[model samples]
Target: MKTLTIRRPDDWHLHLRDGAVLEGVIADTSRHFARAIIMPNLVPPVVTAQDAVAYRDRILTALPQGDRFQPLMTLYLTEGTDPDDVAAAKESGLITAVKLYPAGATTNSHGGVRDIDKAMPVLERMAEIGLPLCVHGEVTTPEVDIFDREAVFIETVLDPLRNRLPELKVTMEHVTTKDGVDYIMGSSGNLAGTITTHHLIINRNAILVGGIRPHYYCLPVAKRENHRLALRAAAASGDKRFFLGTDSAPHVDPLKECGCGCAGIYTSPNTMSCLAHVFEEENALDKLEAFTSLNGPAWYGMAPNEETMTLVRQEQPVSYPSKRDTGAGAITVFDPMFPLHWQVVE
Candidate 1:
């Protein structure tokens, strides 16, 4: 098993922020992932089809020359979203799904849907049109403990929504709990989940144990060891319900190192290598293609990539840069806190 080749993978979830940050990180993702569900949680948010198209165009403009990558755009689902506009976006083939971020859930989510009821017309339309809703599955109430948000979201939000709209397709993005895994597994065909590379590797300990390692911190804040094990098991299980979504969020070093740090891990540069090591460790390398390449496209009703990527296991450790320079500022790369030996050779 010195070398592993699979269909080029797609990131079911990703965040390529606009402007200088977008320019700095787009290539890192395009180098390995063939396509990604581009997140819509920018400053103003891409809340309409026209916004998604413009954002997609900007992404293309920023894409490194000679890199073949597709940006799968999504619209932010605000309370006032126009169903006709949404349906038209889908028909026009410029948008792939709609995103719902509970207001104040994460970065730039202030415009997110506050009342699920208010957004139902849009959700119902999505269900009718067979469009998937990508939800940031966390409750933003002040009383809930940070670690409990994902579980609470499942019990209080997602379950009820699914029961209410059985026909709507949904992806619980960057799921971080055993409860989430169980919920998705116990569900019918309309539901699926994407596991992040960092989530599968780190837990609360990584963020709080030694010191406050801000870089290791992320939304749906990584849970306890048991939850991390659950995520790893789900990903390596070869189940179609689970797939890769790096959630490779990038923030400048200043923002992350300051008093109030942002939540995200910049892992696009090393995700495939880390995943290769993880799958190999689980002795489930045979199923890596399913988790990384095959399952996401299947969920989205698309053909798997014709292009292929080969990862070779070098005897020596692979060295990835600790930080990437965005010119605007430096963005720290995710340190898995373990040596990686696998490299994407082609």
Candidate 2:
């Protein structure tokens, strides 16, 4: 097996929650990603330029000493989001993009946009400022089946948004279905998508094969086997439009195991190792560099990181954290679908 080394990768999307939980989990991410687009769905939400700056500072302070990880910030889009605030944050470089979460769609998303149509003013401002809108593309309608939420979202929300605001740039975060891949490939230039590590490695069966695995349950939850195959194809196609975004969200073990579990997958620790295994399996190891390193920066209109990291194909079993002591009792670490045989060579 050939050993591969390339520029350090950037996680285009991540959730490094604030306070003690943030302190406990930031290191695993810093060890792997040189930078990451920090999500803004905090309890109150990072809704303004000031909020973004303060959050960025907290992340910087939380980073392990001597580490050079940069946390790119984003604002949570809401109905009342000020256009000037969006433009100011982008201009000041305090925020890189704006995230639109359909209210009630995901964790701590109650403060998200209630009506997408009503939020066109904010979208228009984003387009004018050249700030990309990263979206949690599932609709929250009660009538939509859980499995079909993503596809339904594309038909109802994304398709209309694309047509209405043709100039607006958007990134569909953590896409898990064939429809998502096809839509992204079809839209090519104006729209792009971020495929997460867990989505690429597991399908719905992995969640229900033996029992209901809560760790495998995430927003825009894993799709059917055929969709999983489609996602793998897109990632290995050597396509620049598809790239890495770990959406490495963490929840204390109790929150995940409670009656109503939180929606997120903590994959920071094994992200790159998992991706290496997937690409190698597809015989697309040659294109892994572009997917992990080149594509994310290109999509964000930034330069690829100059530093390099290496990975070797070796069989090793890494332990999953049963509980992380994040000030609370413990937060559970998510397990990717299979045994990871490849590991990053520090």
Task: Give the winner by TM-score.
Answer: 1
Candidate 1 deviant stretches above 4 angstroms: none
The true-versus-predicted C-alpha distance at residue 242 of model 2, in Å, is 0.5
Question: Model 1 misses residue 103 by how many Å?
Answer: 0.4
RMSD of each: 0.6, 1.3
How much lDDT does each candidate structure score? Answer: 0.94, 0.88
Candidate 1: 10-residue stretch with minimal lDDT: 321-330
* TM-scores vs. true structure, each candidate: 0.99, 0.97
Best by lDDT: 1
Expressed as tens digits, the lDDT of each residue in 203-292 for candidate 1 is 999999978999998998999999999999999999999999999999999999989999999999999999999999899999999999
